[model samples]
Target: MSGWKEIILLEEKGISVDEFVSGFETPNKLILLEGCLDKWPTLKKLDRDYLVEVCGDNRFAVGPAQMTLTDYFVYSDQAQEERPLYLFDPKFANKRPDYRWIIIGPAGSGSSFHIDPNSTLAWNAVVKGSKKWVLFPPDVVPPGVYLSSNGAEVACPVSITEWFMNFYESTKTWKKKPIECVCKAGEVIFVPNGWWHLVINLEDSIAIRQNFVNRRNL
Candidate 1:
C-alpha cells in the first residue's frame, strides 16, 4: 500500500460557508463582503439608471451600488479607478484584512475566477444580479495560484494544501451543485481563508464586502 495514503482518509463533504469558517483552525481570511447593500442610502440610490450613468465610458462593469446577490461574478473593469487591487499589493492590506469586495455591474465590476491578495481567503456577495463561483484549495494548486499566460493553473510551491490537489470533481460539476446562495438585501456569508472563487453577474448587481480575520482566531 502507498505509505502516505495510510495516514489520511478523505471524503467529499458538503458544508455551508459559515460552517466551513467555524470548523477550520486557520483564521478565516475571507467573508461574504456585504456591507453597502445592507444599508438604506446605498439601496435607495442604486437603480438601473444610476448604474448606467456611473459606468459611463468604463462599461467594463456597472450596476446599482445597492442591488445584492448572494452569488458569484466574473472579472471586469470598464471603470476601475486603477488601484492596488489590480496590482495586488500585500503591503496595503489591513491588519485583519481577511476579506475584500468587488462592486459588480455598471459602476462596480465584472470579476472572474482568481485568488485574493497574498493568497489569502476571499468571498463575495452580489448586491444586484446573480453570479457564479468556483474554488480550489491551496493544495490543488501544485506550485501556486498565479495568473499566467496559460490560465488559472500554475507551478505552485510545496506549502500548498492537499485538498486542492486531491479534489477530483470537475469545476463544471461543482458549479452545477456549488453552494448556490442569494444574499438578498441583508443576508451575509463567510468564506474560509485560501479558498478559490469565481463570480459572474446575473443582472446589474451591486454589493459591498470586507476582509477580516476571524475574531476568535479559529
Candidate 2:
C-alpha cells in the first residue's frame, strides 16, 4: 500500500477495526473521521466577548487556548472541565471522561510536533479554520531534545511550533515529508499515541479534540 499522498486522502478501505486495533502503527493514517463531531453545533458555544474576557485577560496567556480556560475561571485544575469529568478515568491520574476541548483563535496559532507525556493516543476535529498537521516516526526523534520553550503548562508550551522536530538533518540530505492537511469545520482526525505531530490553525478556526487509550494498550 504505497503511493503519493494528499491532505484529504480518504482512509484506506478494508482497514478493519480489529486490524486497526492490532497493528495501528506510527506514521500510519491521518484519518478524517467523517461526521464525528457533526452532532455538536458550530459556533453555538463559542462567544467572542465572553471568551475574549477569559482569553485576553492580562493574567492569562495573553491569548486563547485550552490552558487559558483552565486558569482564572470556573475550571479547576484538579477538576475536569468536561461534563462529568469524572465520567472517565484520567489517562494516568484518573482518566477524565472528557479528553476533548475547543481551539478557537485567529490565524498563526498552532502547535508543535512532540509526543505528549506517556504516549497518549489523541485526535483533532475542526469546527472553523483549517489545521496543518506534520508528523514524524519515533525513530526519527532528534538527538538534541530539550525544553523548546518550557514544559507544558497544560497547553501554552504545547503552543510552540515543531521547531524542535524540524531542527535536524541537513536540508540537502533529507527533506521532511510532513503529512500536512487542513481539518475544515466538520472533520476529525485520530492521532495515534507517540506519533509526533504539529498543527496550525489556517485561519480564525475552531475545533474540539481529545485523546484516548487504545483498547489494546490497556
Candidate 3:
C-alpha cells in the first residue's frame, strides 16, 4: 500500500463524549478507538463456544437458507468456498431496531466496498479476533466499485479477497488514498456518513455494529 496512512487513533479514556461529538461534527473522518470496549462483559465472555451454548438453537438467515449457530460453525469450519458464509441476522433489526447487528464470520469472510444506508453514521465494535478495514471517503469511489446512474445499486468484485488481490494496490499510488487499519478485539471504528468501507476478518471474528442518525449528521 503506497499512500498507506492510518486513520486517526484515539484512546477511549483520552477523549470525552463531548469532545468526540465536537470533532465528529467537523472532520468527517474515520477514527479507530482503542480500548473502547475493554470493560464490556461481552469482550471477555463472548466467543464461538459461548454463543453456541446460548444461541445455538436460534436460526439465522445465511444467504438463502436459515442455519443455527452450531450448524453455521460446523459449516464455517469446513467451508472451502472463496467467500465463506457469514452470520448477519436481519431478524435482529426487528428485535432491537436501534442496534444494527451482531456479525460472526471466519477468516476469509467479509463485506466488500459499500456505504451505509440512509446516510447514517456507524460504529463497529470488535469483541473477538481482528479485522482489516479499508475505507474511502464519499467522493472517492473505490476503483473496482461501480454505482448505477441513479445511485441505487452498485457492482463490484464478487468477493472481498478478490478486490484486495486485484484493486488494492492501485489505491496506494493515488494522491488521496483510503484510510486503512487493522481493528483488533476491544476496539471500535467510527465511520462517518457516506464513507465507503470494506472489512475482512483476519481471524474468526465477532462484532457488533450500530448505525444512527444524530443532530450533527441530520
Best by lDDT: 3
Off-target runs (Cα >4 Å) in candidate 2 are 1-8, 11-29, 38-98, 142-176
Put down candidate 1 lDDT per residue, 139-181, tens digits, no spaces: 3441233546865454333221232344323433542233333
The segments of candidate 1 whose C-alpha lies over 4 angstroms from its true place after superposition are 1-41, 48-102, 106-109, 142-186, 215-218
Total clashing pairs for each candidate: 55, 8, 0
Candidate 3 per-residue lDDT over residues 22-44, each given as its tens digit: 77634666778898987787788
TM-scores for all candidates? 0.43, 0.56, 0.93
**How much does candidate 3 score in TM-score?**
0.93
Clashes, model 2:
8
Winner on TM-score (1 vs 3): 3
Error of 1 at 193 (Å): 1.8
Instruction: Name the lDDT value of residue 170 in candidate 3.
Output: 84
State the lDDT at 95 in candidate 1: 51
Pairs that collide in candidate 3 are none
Model 3: ten consecutive residues of lowest lDDT: 1-10
Prediction 1 TM-score vs. true: 0.43
